[model samples]
Target chain A: MIEVKDLRFVYPNGVEALRGVSLKIEDGEFVAIMGQNGAGKTTLVKHFNGLLKPTKGDVYVDGVNTKDVSVATLARKVGYVFQNPDHQLFCESVEQEVAFALKNFGFDQETIEKRVSWALQLLGLTQYRQVSPFMLSGGERKRVALASVLAWDPKVVILDEPTIGQDYAQKEKLRQFIMQLRTQKKTVVIVTHDVEFVAECQPRIILMKNGKIVADGSAKEILTNPEVLLQASVIPPQITQTFHYLKDIGLPTNVIDVYEARETILEFLGETKK
Target chain B: MRFMVARESVEVIKTEKLTFTYAGRNEPSIRDVGLSIEKGEFVILTGPSGCGKTTLCRCFNGLIPHFYQGKLEGEVIVAGLKVNEHPTYELACHVGLVFQNPENQLFALSVEKDVAFGLENLGLPREEIRKRVDWAMKVAGVYELKDRAPYELSGGQQQRVAIASVLAMRPEVIVLDEPTSFLDPLGAKRIFEDIYKLNQKLGITVILVEHRLDLAAKYATRVIVMNDGRVLLDGDPREVLSLEKTRLLGVGIPKATRLYQLLKNDGIPLKSGKVPLTPEEAAEAIKEAFKSD
Candidate 1:
């Protein structure tokens, strides 16, 4: 569990990235933080992992104040996959990269090997286990970065832009992986601009703007609210946009899922039993 | 060759049997890819990851054989110059390649300096550099951020600055490798419109590598899909994007197109019998279907 109270943060250069943001993420909750660039979405998530301490408020992670605990201690629970894979990938090979975190956490040699193989296979990087991470493609490298983080089995996994540079198939794989994580009841948080992915996942949505939380609600509520989404610079999913544009034809504007939109349109066309 | 002599050719980019294998890699990244892009065409190159989209883009601007150590075979001619024969510096004037990551390309402290970097390297006059810098910045919609450092800006904003820097060179062929990956949908739409306008007004051939087909499909004159280092499909956007083979390859089909397919599957056909690539087009098609009934 993580909680923030009136969180405010200012960079050393005097740029206030977060302003009095307050939110609470319950245990095993799946959440998505979304907004335009520079809207303080990343700033807010950095607090969850104790990467950035609040300048004026407090962040509590697992019942401990972030200011009191060191970042190393927080690492055991929170695993952050950076926006750029290159920032975190430094091991010589894919296998070593995944094992690096487990070894650091002082896991047994046998456990480290098992976890590394498991992570590589889960992310479809087993074929590249012996290859250098630097030699992989951009998307492949992203998977390597994700494998390295997930190897530690952190309780809370925060993925920053996991869908960027990924293709449709890889994204589907990631979506399934996230669903599997949910079955295990891991707290998953993602900061992204991939609305289609969000529409499919339907995680609890938190919309931020200008360094403050503007809206927080279920995915349907936050995504279909045009006024709130507009303020955050987020465009609704294509199905929602299609339905919204068809509002003049008496179709409902709140449909975010494609299946729901299809049924609603069919019913409106007098082709279905309502 | 230090100087380039203009050749009157309508085909801005052409590749024949182009194959490349990175050093120390057994498998080829690109294989026997043959393509021809006319002047002023906006082409979207999309594929599954590691399918050689970026490697193919590098071949257009002389980066594949020149900068990247690779075994290259066959011919690629961009802006009438054989890429293997011309150095990157000479090709930079005609073909500007915007890298996948904006941070890799932007280096100046301020947006203005970054936009002017390419022009200054060409030994352009100060007045000309100033004029082009302002014009390109405004075109990419980054003029308001002229004094801000690139690092200080958001990912989307920095992407615009990178594009502006490339535009300042007035390259005839601009190949952008997923330039708007960090931008929001609205911002991405605006950038696509800007690139569309440049292609229309200046007749600059655009080769855009991207995966956001939901937003980008409408702007592309043609769509090319690759799989496992081979061109699986290439043609008009509507035709190419609607292929089952393309969909099976895991390319992102525009949601609008998907909706069209779903409707068709349910026995409701749009009046045009064509796939809609954007929401507005889909809405118009549905409205027309309703009116005809």
Candidate 2:
């Protein structure tokens, strides 16, 4: 579980990236933090892993105050995948990249090998295990970065913009991987602007604007309400927008999934035919 | 008499049996790909990662055979000059390629200096370079940010400055590779809008490589889908995007188009028989369907 208590952060350049924000995530929860570029989503998540100390209030990760623990101490419990894979990838080969973190956490050689192999297989990078990470494509390198983080088996995983350079197929695979993580009861948090992906995952949505949390709730509640989403500069999913436009024709405005919207429209067509 | 008023359609970029294999690579990156793009057309080139999208773009500005040290076999003509025959600097004036990352393209300290960097290399007069830089910055909507350092601006601002730098060259053709992957939805939309204005107002031939088709589909005059180093689909946006093959190739269909397909599959017909590319169009079709009933 992760919790933030009225967290306020001020950078050395006098930019108040976060302003009196408070939130909590239960164990095994899947939450998505969304907003514009300068909305402080990254700043807020960096505090969870002790990357940024709070200027005011407090951050607690697994019942330990973030201020008390070093970033290395929190890495054992929380894994952070940066927005740019190039920023985090330094190892020569993909296999070494995944094993570096496990070795750092003091895992034995056998455990490290097993964990690295499992992670490599999970991300479909096993075939390129011996290949230099720099030689892979941008999307493949992103998978390598993800494999490296997941290899550690951190209790809480924070992914910053995981869908940035990924294609449609890779995104589907990522969605399935996120579900697999949920089955294992690992807490997952993603900061992204990919509304279509978020609509499908349906994680608890947290909307931020100008360093403050504007709204927080289920995807259906937050995504369907246009006024609140507009405040955070989030565009609703296309299916949701279609329903919003069809509200005068007796369609509910809360539909976010395409399949659900299709079924509802089919049912409406059936009734209108009578 | 009819020819007097009709505008001539000139082919700006043409590739014939274009095959390129990078040095030390067993297989070719792009194989036997042939296509022709007319001047002033907006083309969206998209495919999955490692599917030869970037390799094909590199061929446009002579980067493959010259700078990349690749085995190039094919004919590529851009702006009346063969790609392999002329140097990249010569082609740079006619075809401006903006990379995915804006930081890679920007090097000067300030935005104005970055915009003027290309013109300076071309040995243009100082007065001419200054005028073009100001014009490009205003057109890219980055005029106010001319004094700010490249690292100080946000992602969207940095991307705009990058566009300005390319626009300053006054290139006849501009190719952007996934330019909005770093921006939010709104920022992406704004960037697309700015590019659209450039294509519409200035008649610059655009080859935009992107994955976010929902926002970009509405603006494309033509959509080219590539897979496994092959041109899979190319045609009008509606016709190409409506096909089942494009969807099976893992290209993201516009959401409005997906909704149209879903309704069509379920034995329901929208008022407009064509696929809607935007939410507004889909809503209009839905309203018409109910009104007729």
Interface RMSD of each: 1.8, 1.3
Candidate 1: which stretches are off by over 4 Å?
A: A270-274, B1-9, B288-293
Q: Total clashing residue pairs per candidate? A: 0, 0
For B1-293, candidate 1 gives per-residue lDDT tens digits of 59787865599888999999999999999999999999888999999999999999988888889999989998999888999999987888888888767898888899999999888888999999999999999988899999999998877788889888888888998999998777776677777788888899888999999987887888899999998898988899999988877888899887777777777678865657667888777777666545533
Q: Which pairs clash in model 2?
A: none
Q: lDDT tens string, model 2, A92-137?
A: 8999999998988899999999999999999999999998998788
Give candidate 2 regions above 4 Å deviation.
Answer: B1-5, B288-293
lDDT of 1 at B27: 93
Work out the iRMS of candidate 1.
Answer: 1.8
Clashing pairs in 1: none
